[model samples]
Target: MIRHIVLFKFKPGISWDDPRALEAEGMAAKVGGEVPDLQEWSTGRNISTRPIAYDFAVIGLLEDEAALDRYLVHPFHQEAIRRWREISEWVIADLEE
Candidate 1:
């Protein structure tokens, strides 16, 4: 399986309560059940207060690279990305498990 991880950092002045952030969170929360290729999906606001910590996280498990590719391009995922882009910047990693 492939472990897909994303860490998002809100832009200056953006907060979790922002409407766009909420919309992005809602869209991402639905991806696990909506995408066939996604074996698992979990996303949420970061709880750590450490300075290095990001604002949010998204973790997904997929069967393989192909499945990971499909999940990345899925319409629901794309929409979530779009919403997130409006409020934050993110970094991602994909690893074999």
Candidate 2:
């Protein structure tokens, strides 16, 4: 399986990020069915309580390298990423497991 991880920190003065989180999570919930080659997907938003770890994280489990590449170039994922970039700072890592 391919595991895709992302961490995000919201930009100052941006408050719509919760909706972004919801949207991302919602989309992720639908991935395995709508998009081929996905095994599972999940996303989480940061709570107001502070933690030493990175802000928010998203975890996606996919079928293989090709599926991961498909996710990378998928239009829906691209759109979500564009929206995310507008709202926050982020870091991403994709791993094989």
Candidate 3:
């Protein structure tokens, strides 16, 4: 399996209540249901005020690298990524488990 983690930092001045932000967050959280290859998935807004904390995160597990690739190209996942790109910058890490 592969553990895929993504952390997002919203652009400065972007409000949490913004419709784009809400849609980006919701889309990320619901991606698991839309992408069949995802073994697990979760996403949420950060409650922390710490400067080092990202504004949002997505944690997911895929069956393997191929599954991870499929997830990346899946239309739903792409749509989520597109929404996020308009409002944030993000970092990602993938680990074999």
Candidate 4:
């Protein structure tokens, strides 16, 4: 299985209650249900106050690289990414497990 992980940092001065932030958060929260080849999906806001912490995270599992690729290009995924782009920056990691 491929474990796909993403970490997001909200833009400076943006609050979690902001409309755009809420929309992006909602999209990320629901993407797994709307996409295919996703074996598992989870996302959440960060509770840590440490400097190294990001504001949000997404952890998901796919069958393999091909499925991971499909998830990347899927419309629902793209839409979530688009919404996120407006309010944050993110990084990702993919691991074979």
Candidate 5:
């Protein structure tokens, strides 16, 4: 399986309570159930108080590269990406497991 992880950093002045942030959070929460290729998925705000920690994260497990590719382009995922882009920048890592 492929383990896909994404970390998001909110832009300057953007907070968790921002409308755009809330929308992105809601969209991300729904992607797992909406996309068939995602075997496992979870997303949430960071609880760490330390500096340098990302504001949000997403972890998804897919059966293979093809499934990972499909999840990356899924409409629900795309919509979440669009919403996130409005409030933050992100980095991702994909690993084989």
Candidate 6:
């Protein structure tokens, strides 16, 4: 299964230039470590784009939907998301395929 994660609308002025933002993404990526089913992980902070809906995009390929859910509720994910929420606003969607 392919799971796409996009996070949008950070607090105004939080740019990719911010070291904190960069570190946050790095930490978020680490969440994949806890889930063995994640076949591939791709993530990035938007560099330059016109009218992009999100500030970041993280894509995960997993063995199955259950593994995707594990990725969502993973302890590292909870920790990383908690930290992100403290710094910015966000919205996400799960595309099932």
In model 2, how large is the Cα lDDT of residue 7?
A: 85
The lDDT per prediction is 0.89, 0.71, 0.92, 0.94, 0.92, 0.72
**Candidate 5 Cα lDDT to native:** 0.92
Give one digit per residue, the lDDT tens place, for model 4 in 35-71. Answer: 8789899999999999989999999999999999999
Candidate ordering by lDDT (highest first): 4, 3, 5, 1, 6, 2
Worst 10 residues of 5 by lDDT: 16-25
Tens digit of per-residue lDDT, candidate 2, span 3-97: 88888777776554468755655664555466565677676766766745555677788888888888888877777777678667888888888
Candidate 5 at 61: error in angstroms?
Answer: 0.3
Q: Which portions of model 6 show Cα errors greater than 4 Å?
A: none
- Candidate 3, residues 8-48, lDDT tens digits: the string is 99899887888999988888878989999998888887899
User: What's the CA RMSD for each of the models?
Assistant: 0.9, 2.8, 0.8, 0.7, 0.7, 2.2
Q: What residue pairs are clashing in model 4?
A: none
Against the hidden reference, what TM-scores do the models get? 0.94, 0.73, 0.96, 0.97, 0.96, 0.75
For model 5, residues 1-97, the per-residue Cα lDDT tens digits are 9999999999999997788888889899999899999889999999997889999999999999999888888888888898999899999999999
Off by over 4 Å in 3: none
Stretch of 10 with least lDDT, candidate 3: 23-32
The alpha-carbon lDDT assigned to residue 19 of candidate 5 equals 84
Candidate 1 vs candidate 4: the TM-score winner is 4
Clash pairs for candidate 5: none
Clash count per candidate: 0, 0, 0, 0, 0, 0
